[model samples]
Target: MSGPRGSLVGQQLRVATTRFAHGGHAVARDDDGRVVFVRHALPAEVVQVRVTRGKAGDRFVFADVEAVETANPHRVTPPCQYAGPGGCGGCDLQHADLGYQRELKAQVVAEQLSRLAGIERDVLVEPVPGDVDGLRWRTRVEFAVDREGRAGLRPFHTRDVLPIDDCLIAAEPIIDSGVLRRRWPAQRAVDVIAPSGSGSAADSESDPGSDPGSHPGSPAAVLVPVPGGVKQAPEVTEHVASGPWSGDITVDARGFWQVHPGAASTFLDHVLGELDPQPGERALDLYAGVGLFARALADLVGDEGAVLAVESDERAVVAGERDTARVEQLEWRAERVEQALEPLIDGGDEVDLVVLDPPRAGAGAPVIRQIAQLSPRAIAYVACDPAALARDLATLADAGYELDTLRAFDAFPMTHHVECIAICRPSSAIRG
Candidate 1:
């Protein structure tokens, strides 16, 4: 309940603009010094809001949407059910028009680089193409268990569970899971293992619908990272993929993922298309999880090509390695991709290319330095959070690499979330 700035109990003001944070919201001021955070608001929006929480000297104020006095022309209606009840926090930009959403996201990238990373000049590449459906793409999701033996999503910033009628963004089968209705408030964790017909109690009821049906011959499960307070933790976990292309992908019920399956594939296709891997090239896949692109990269490298699949989560890395055996030369090691650079790049390995598919926060400083020091011939970076991406880009560019390709993709249709992939190469290329 403590917000940035002073105590604003009675402050009333009109919000001028909406920016994406936890989600899309309008910004406003209460008197001087203190800023207010409002949800369901847009830029150039006029509305009176009451202060819900406040803090002093920090930054902004946080408040719920009261009313809309003036609205921006770009604002549009959201289509997803449970979009606001807090059940489906999946789509954050639904209220904004598609084109307008792209513009706001672009601004976010630029600001993060300049303001946080301290890099002033950057070519904010045009956003990658966007998808329209914004729903039914999620392969992994964790839900809550209520007293009524029912499960659903908890409200944002609160533990109040709102049972879902249906999740538009969930893969068709998972959405129809009886698990959604049968609340299993285990005092322990639930593990859904990959490759069906395994021996487990949950497996008995998993049914055909629960199977993600991902990639062929891929082992390992998509273990949902739930909090540590269920009663009995299960022995085996499951890896859920929307399609038959599985490798082990996990998502906390509230964590972020591409809302469009086709879009994820599209981005993957772009990476595969551009890199054009040669047989002998060894790649460093930073922040690699579930080894999506890592797997594809390993394949391209063939028997001669080795991929150093680095990830922070030990389980995920193990799973990724186990699954990547399909490609022969792929190796998995558990380490914070953003933090571990010195030891990994200590001269033993000759990594020709570097790839990073980071989460929303983007890559911190350490990994960025390695990419520079190793000075790979090419670096492919996939980012969900534009601000963090911009910040990291500033670091890489200053380290002497030149930005060669910049493309953005809009995977989350309704929300402000967008994905961008950039390709960087050495400052000087050898002339043929």
Candidate 2:
């Protein structure tokens, strides 16, 4: 399958993969010494990869494993029919065993930390509770609608919708909702949410999954994009039982929440454990969504201490405020993290602990420097992308903070996504 080495856009090359890389690709060098990011292949396996993107002169060419001349011992038949080279792009490591999937994710995290942050650490991807086989854990699924009104998922690197009858990663209630069985005539996509709790009897009796508000936990269900504009989606009740905290938080279904069922509680446990909030200790929760961490911090801080939760989305702040009305110590500020940090920095406001769950991009240098000025006793950084986390950690290091403890979670199994929580402390605060 090898053609001229100068152009490899559509060429096929058999190469031996050396190691696993981020974004669900394996590392391999072609005959011409150009790096090939091969999908659907494992390390040390010789596979023929068909270049899907990039030309010869590029640093690396994207390719899909066309034929595996040699396969890894951990390779197993994919549970989903649509998980191979040309199938659905939702899952990346379905071919590998669940344990191996976690191993690969851990390697990615460690590699990113070592390369980007110069921090050499062995990362173990821990499985959240109730993750038996890395399937049926997704509480939220977005089904893309094809031109013919069929709901399905899209392939990677393209807008073409692949019609699928079922998504194995979705929770049982979502599939029971018969979302894929129906048709969307004029919609582009359908957003489905299945909360952890069970719906009420009336919600159960109604047309299940079709009506967003019909199910008890399934709030803002079946969000369809229409011409005139969709109505205000209803709020969903999510119960958190992490550590000593157990309470119900109401958030809009369309709002930002972890897609995995156990992700929120898992992250919360680690955050609370790392920060170890004490009474009369002030704290800050940046990019707080529905006050997940803020509420927990407020409870631990008691009446004398205050906790500020800043979020760019006003709606989220309003929802968080309404849900935590009794907590007088918690204050929700509807503004950007940068905007909130400016006032705190300018007024010489010092915080005892800081928990920031930044987006995939991670908190950049500006925000990292600003937070460093506060000089919190400890900072908990919850991140979805390891590369971004490593970069931000580097910035924090430059600002007199050292990487204390880092933990990675296999929250999004079968995919390249791995959640990481890094605890950074001021250099002088690190105990020998």
Tell me the whole-model lDDT of each prediction, alpha carbons only: 0.60, 0.85
Q: What value of lDDT does candidate 1 attain over all alpha carbons?
A: 0.60
Residue-pair clashes per candidate, as listed? 39, 2
Residue range with the least summed lDDT across 10 consecutive positions in model 2: 198-207
Tell me the deviation in Å of residue 62 in model 1. 1.8
Best by TM-score, which number?
A: 2
| Candidate 1 wrongly placed segments (more than 4 Å) | 1-6, 9-12, 18-23, 56-58, 85-90, 114-132, 185-259, 338-344, 429-432
Off by over 4 Å in 2: 1-7, 198-231
lDDT of 2 at 390: 96
Query: What's the residue-level lDDT of 121 in candidate 2?
Result: 98
